[model samples]
Target: MPETNTARLVHRLATLRERLQPEMDRREFLRTLVTGGYALGMAQLLGVEDFLAADDGEVPIVTARVRENPDDPFSLVEQTRDVPAEWYAAVQNAFELNERLARIAYTGYLGSAVVPGDYASGTASISIGVSNEGQSAREMIRDVSEGISINTETIIEIEEIEDGFEYAEPRYVESVDDGRVPSGIACETPSSLATLSPALYHPDEEEAFFVTAEHAFKDEPDPVGHPLALPLDRVERLELGTVVYAHPGEDFVAVEPNGEMRPVSRIAAPSPVRVRGQYTRLGLADLVARGEELEKVGALTGHTTGRIQGVDAVTCFTDEFCRRGQIRWGGEMDLTDGDSGSVSYHSDPDGRDDDVLVAGFNNARTWWPGQSYVWGVSAYKLTAEHGYHF
Candidate 1:
């Protein structure tokens, strides 16, 4: 029997190697080996019997109980408001204009980021807008420096230059210590033209921010509990804790409250497809079915039905020991590096619109063969625990 088991194990290993060969690189192979060893060790200690028992196929059946509504035969009335033709036409025109402007702005912004700058001798090729046409390259660099100072002091460090222009090569900066000016800065500029833009001078200014959807805390000294905040605008910041369960190979980084810095293994991608209004309609069917079932059984006596209005990814961190898996949203949207701690909201009852409910925070992306998964923290759970209405 032992000989037979050994033969089976060898066959399995050979099959795994054969299957993995097509896409496996050195790093991937090493990662697989490590993960496989860990799994085997865990199985041996925990006993595979319980693990196998946990896989029993059991489908839950939901039963509905009837309930009588006190307010029977509630009148269903259509609320109507008349709009003047001129007002309607004006609104339509405004919408069209706004849409055109938005499209132009988005295209120009992304185009500028991807475009390469012209490299000239004796001067670095900097991005010049209509506003900065007359400014000298040196002056432009100064302005960029000032802007960085205003937002984050001395985050950009100028290190030694290599074969390429400053805009084309990575530039390193000294570590930010007490916001004081150190001897020098160090960083490598990407080949992209957007790197030269004053807008992208700050580390957080670039759209490509990393994100992580692991369990994190607001106030904690441990690396796993360290707070990571993303500046939304000039005045607002979205904060989250660190996730320890993230893939160690990812090289995640976070900023601390005391302005200290640490490296993490998992970081979330910043950009996410913002789902709002009609876009959230995709989940409406499933939500409505569940809601209706609850309503029929009087489970929704005080609850009102609301459609999902918006969805965005937020950052979370795992425990210090990295026992739990980090949670995140995985959707069709392209997420960037700096979007780790964004807040997603549903509808507010006291707000202008009452037809929508903010669902949950989108957390991470899970890539599959042909599709991706969007993971999110359920709003229902948050509301239940925090006594907040959504």
Candidate 2:
């Protein structure tokens, strides 16, 4: 071979090596992510495509449910866990399909939820609820989702609830400490009583709010005009705040704190649970896959625990517009009329003693005879739609 030809070949090889170095580095980082069993989602942060390749290997996924900085609710530090590649692919596909179903939101579409299968099965499904007049809609859903598995149920008319459905009296705020009030207690609206939710924080405005069910003030001509008053045991009622934002689609209201006693990140229960953060959509699905249960403290029902039935759910049973990104758990017995605004929660898997993550707000429950479950807007949904976090 001549010298010029040899030099040209060497240059070509060098150029090829330069192009492949970044790819090699990315693969090495991914391998570390698998073996090390943790990641900060650097790929997503950097907008690096092909970070996760299709191979018969493990992959890292976010499993942590808290932020590194509690004050900055949006600063979600990704805590990841390694899982089989096949399982990740299956779950990811199911999630995508679920979102598609939600977007379609066809007529008579009562609701839907995602149910992830175990690791060994590497499968997932969507549970769809349809009204009696939804046969065509059901066929349409089947047409759009070809390979995904779906379970369908027909929602029928429900009879009126029994007249004498008795419940315990409302719980009032006995006292306040450090100028802060604990959640899970009762607060009085102009029209009705409701349970208080944990402190809701908005990242954009950097403001904290005391939240409750918007429907509690339905009878009032102007919900925002009336103050949200906290009834004390023996003392005069203390005005906590007034409605700053009313989200009827999600069925919750955010009250701007007006008095010294503001909402705290704690629940008033037998064993007090501290609010750390909230679960993502996939996080809730993972809990369902592992057969985990959610607990809640309502003013009337007190503390109760129940298994998660579904996640990323959509419900159109009662309202004019469909409510998306909901969670269905427990049974109707877990919630009552006064239990509205109570939040569903679960123990933080990666937190200190008594730390819990907010799942969603318990707004309403099923009344039909054949079906029985409590449903509400998930915490992830609230954050995704309105930028509020617990």
Q: What is the C-alpha RMSD of each candidate to the true structure, in Å?
A: 25.2, 9.4
Poorest lDDT segment (10 consecutive residues) of candidate 1: 192-201
lDDT by residue (tens digit), candidate 1, 1-390: 356976977776555444333234345544665555435454433333332332222111111111122121121121212222222222223223323322343211110000111111111111111112222233433443322211111111112212211221212222233332111011111110000000000122212122332322213333354444432233443332233323222212222223233212111112111111111211221232222211000000111122221122211212222111112222323222222222233332222332222333333333322323333444333323332111
lDDT of 2 by residue, 259-373 (tens): 6878888999888888888888777767777789999999888899998887888887886778888899998889998789999999887777788889999999888756677
Clash list (residue pairs), candidate 2: none
Stretches of candidate 1 above 4 Å error? 1-330, 334-336, 348-350, 353-356, 383-390
Among the numbered candidates, top TM-score falls to 2
